[model samples]
Target: MSKGNIGVTTENIFPIIKKFLYSDHEIFLRELVSNAVDASQKMKTLSSVGEFNGELGELKVSISIDEKAKTLTISDRGVGMTAEEIEKYINQIAFSGAEEFVDKYKDDANAIIGHFGLGFYSSFMVAKKVNIITQSHKDGAKAVKWTCDGSPEYTLEEVEKEDRGTDIVLHIDEENENFLQKAEITTLLNKYCKFLPVPVVFGNKTEWKDGKEEETAEENQINDVAPLWTRTPSELKDEDYNQFYKDLYPMSEDPIFNIHLNVDYPFNLTGVLYFPKIKNNVEVQKNKIQLYSNQVFITDSVENIVPEFLTLLHGVIDSPDIPLNVSRSYLQADGNVKKISNHITKKVADRLAEIFKADRADFEAKWDSLKLFIGYGMLTEEKFYDKAQKFSLFKNTDGKYFTFDEYKDIIKENQTDKDDQLVYLYTTNVEEQHSFIEAAKNKGYDVLVMDGQLDNHFVNHLEQKFEKSRFVRVDSDVAEKLIPKESTLESQLSAGDKDDLTSVFSAQVPNGDKMNFIVAFEAMGKDSSPAIITQQEFMRRMKEMSAMQGGGGMNFYGEMPDSYQLVVNENHPIVERILADKNEAVGKEADSLRSKIESLNGKRQELEKAKEGKKEEEIEQAQKDELADVDKKISELNTKKTEVLSKFSTDNKLVSQLIDLALLSNNMLKGEALTKFVKRSIDLI
Candidate 1:
């Protein structure tokens, strides 16, 4: 027996590995089984090259769990180490047999595991002691036994004759005794070695007999030596890929289509990417894609491996170019990883374009499921946007799809405003905005259904790409002003009448910084509703973004009241009748008060102008005093105006009813206010 301390620069290595890597301790099985696979594959390579003149028998790896003894063993039939080879590879820290094997069979050792050389030491992660029983295939080489107790010290010596392979037995500690179960070991093997190059066997197949499960006549193999990704695309059928998807995600609905990736140059990448049918909440069907490296499962967190948007896809991606042990942030900075990301993005774009060009009807059939993913990709990646514009479709409410240029041609003439800006009218909730959609349709305009969670950001992206184009919600403004053409109409009511009218309508709606009521006159006909509410784009966007982040229960934007444009059509007969009634009831009294208010307003304007260019604190005291006087005069006139308006609100139920009608249309009338409106409608009728 010979032993020496494992060479390490720091004593913190073991503790660091235990503490930091504890979260991923289950990966220890993958590391140990992978090492056994490496040894098996090495012997095959040597035999192919005439170096090892020996029988290359069954190369299957087997793992057995001994619950009573708390032992988990990984056995393999491959090029095992001799006594001396054990000292150099197993005794020294970080030294790996895969390195020597790769050097000997440089071009033929497919899927060697020596890149990081941490596979062997992964045993220390869970085992209190590990034993290796290996016999080299080299003629006259004796079988060897190597043992270590979670430390640098190891014992190795010639053992009795045995098979030409290795079996690593892990004496699982009390804390990790759970690994002794068949299910636990099976799950870890499936996660890490299900697609490895070598077929791995766990134990004998079992049968339910005599009221119990008993080992069958055959060995229970746990993995497929080669998965669908490593196969030739020509050899694979559509159903084969679909079956593979089912294997990856058993419960997922069938994917719309798949991208078979088999790249040789730049960096070897072999995998299949599928576009799943994603609906409503994004995470309902998550973790559909399983990431692998040379058939070894590294992680499912492929955010940095693939673009953020691509995570919505369901499939497998195996690329040796990605490192095994590192944070996602590191992968983003690695140069090769960036190239891989760019390549995948281009491949996805090209695949979609091909499908769109070859058979658009079939592609369009899947558009609803495909729309969110493409839109999200275009929104997040600038290059994807550039490519997507060619195939990215615009679907009209009539269920017709069009490319950017095609849609622009169809709507350019009718949707262009006086300023020559092309407006894209869209509706997020088709049912809720049905009235607005119908109005736009009646005017011979097309409305798009842009309702995806990312559509807000996507529409903003499209605006920047399409020259002279803007996306407008169907109800952003009244039908006529939505695409304003030759628009200008002055209000005819007197200043006092305008104030009284505003107060009469505004008194019904809640008043706060959030609940703003912008009183505007429109030329809409008498048939149009007397009042309408429209949200401003900027404030609405802030609120929508706040919803996306879910930053807190309710953010500042959420806390702010609803902002609405209280549009009152001045051209309608109802308005003419109201103004005429005001004149007859308070014409003389309002004219007298209006004269006083107008004089004070002119003085207030003069005072504001005098202080416009002055430093905030440097304004003259008299100027401040004069502004106060003007403010008081305006306030007094406003008081008299409010009294008249309050009387109007109490008397004219039609005004309040009209306001409620608009609020109902916008789906904003809620709770007690809604209840009041229902009761008032009965009384009015």
Candidate 2:
């Protein structure tokens, strides 16, 4: 027996490893089992290449938990270390035995998981003491036992051991005695070693017999050795891929489609990414994409490895190119990761394009479920957006689907506005905005159903992508004004009548939470609705994006009240009648006030014109005084005119009914307001 200090830089290495090496202490099982797999694969490689002349026994990894003795042992039949090898590999710090073995057998070895020498020290995270009982497969090599407590000191001695393998025995600490349970050990094994190349047995298999589970003699191998992604795509059927997806997410709905990725040029990557039926809320379905390296599970939070939008996809992405730190808990920002992300984005776009080209009917059939994912990708990644536009579908209000180009071609002739800008009219809710949608359809304009939670941001993105194109909600403006092909009819209302209509409708607008209504007059033909509720596309989009992205100077818009435009069709019969009634109510009073206002404005204009081209001292004080007096008189007359209009508007039930009707059509009228509107509507009828 011999004792020596570990060849490490610091005496506190064990504490650092236990406290800071791994973010999750449970990852110790993954590290140890991965190392065991590496060793088993290396042995097979050496034997095949004639480096070792011996009978290749069954190479299996076993984990045994002894609760009474408080011991958890992991035994692997592999290239175990002899006394000399243990002295060199075990004592040395930061020097990985697997790395040296891989370098020697680089041509023939399977994928080696461990490059850092810290995997063995992970045992100290959950154990008070650890022992390694190992025997070399070399001829005349002595079996060695290495023991280390939770300190720098360790003992290595020659021991009379059994088979040519390694057994790592961890004396479970009182704080981590959960490792001594069969269920806990089984779970760890299943998570980390389920896809390992070698078989990993946790304990004896169980059979349901005599109305209870009984232990059987068969070994309970917890690993599949070859997951679906590890096999070639040609060998896999739809059922195989689906079964694998079910295995990954037991309770998730069937995926809309899948993309099998196999790339080896710049970086080695092989995995299956499934497009799950994502809900409208993108954030809720994130972190479902798991990342792996050479069949060992790394993390589900693959936000860094995949593009931000691809995180919504559910599946596995394994790449040896993804750089991991010592613990393999988090990924470092590497160019390779970015390359992989861009590659994945390309692959996903290509798969969608293929689907769209091969069977567009089928693709459109699944568009409702696939839209969120594709829209998210387009909104987030620039390259993805470029590729996704090819296959992206734009569904019209009539339940018809068209690709971006196809839809553009279909509407480019009619939907182009007076400015030659293509107007894409969309509605967020079909049922709620049914009137607006029908109104657009009546004008022979197509209205897209942009109802997804990300549609607001998506449309904003499309505006930038589509050349000279604008996306306006169907209810964002009146139907004729939405795609204005010709000069609209001038409002027949005089300035005073327009003012009266504005004051009347604006006064009756609902005073709901964070709602502001602006009254405007448009000559949208007599057949149009008397009043229509609409929101400004740009400001509404800013507020919507601000709410989604949640900060970065956009909070100002988000905090502001929702502003809506209450458009009164001046040519409509009801609006004309409302204006007539309002004029009748305030006609006499409005005339007297307008005459006085015009006299004051005429006097003030002459005085302002006299001072326009003069120097400050050249202007007379009497002229300034006169101008001030005239401005005060004009302001007073205007106030009196507003008072007459307000009085007439407040007394008119039709004004309130029109405003409520607009709100009801837009799904804004609710509760007491809706009830009041119904009562008023019946009374008017």
- Which stretches in model 2 have alpha-carbon errors above 4 Å? 207-214, 488-490, 511-513, 610-629
TM-score of 1: 0.91
> For residues 73-182, what per-residue lDDT tens digits would candidate 1 score against the true structure?
89888888788787778766667567666776778876876555666776777888888888888888889888878655667766885688888888988887888888
Q: What is the lDDT of residue 300 in candidate 2?
A: 89
Residue 438 Cα positional deviation in candidate 1, in Å, after optimal superposition: 2.4
lDDT at residue 162 of model 2 (Cα atoms): 79
Measured by TM-score, how close is model 2 to the native structure?
0.94
Error of 2 at 181 (Å): 2.6
lDDT of 2 at 321: 79
Model 2 misses residue 39 by how many Å?
A: 2.1
In model 1, which runs have C-alpha deviations exceeding 4 angstroms?
3-23, 209-214, 283-287, 326-333, 488-496, 512-514, 550-559, 580-592, 599-633
C-alpha RMSD values across all candidates: 3.6, 2.3
Model 1 root mean square deviation, Cα atoms: 3.6
lDDT computed for candidate 1: 0.80
